[model samples]
Target: MSKKEKFEELLKRLQEISEQLESEDLGLDKAVKLYEEGIKLSKLCHQKLEAAELKINELKSDVTAK
Candidate 1:
């Protein structure tokens, strides 16, 4: 799959994690596990976005230089 597809999948999982975290009756251990997973997903998403942004900026600069 492409980076965009992977990023979209990660974003969807992050939203799922958020919903799970917000549940009223979740067990402490399960919540903690989900929270850790969510943190990993969040970091991955941030990295993906930062990489995409840098690539876009580089493309813009290249176009300007041409």
Candidate 2:
């Protein structure tokens, strides 16, 4: 999948996990597992955003240099 699609999918999964985590019926073990997955996804999303930001900055710099 493309970067944007992967990011969106990760974000969607994070949202689903957030909703699941909010439920009162979730068991502790499962909640912990979901929380762990959420953390990983969150880091990935952060990395994607950072990479995009860097790319945008580089593009702007190139335009300014010309």
Separate clash counts for every candidate: 0, 0
**Candidate 1 lDDT by residue in tens digits, 1-66:** 335457778889999999999999999999999999999989888877666643333333556666
| CA lDDT scores, all candidates in order | 0.83, 0.84
Model 1, position 60, has a per-residue lDDT of 38
- The true-structure Cα RMSD of candidate 2 reads 6.7
TM-score of each: 0.70, 0.71
The TM-score of candidate 2 is 0.71
Summed over model 2, clashes come to: 0
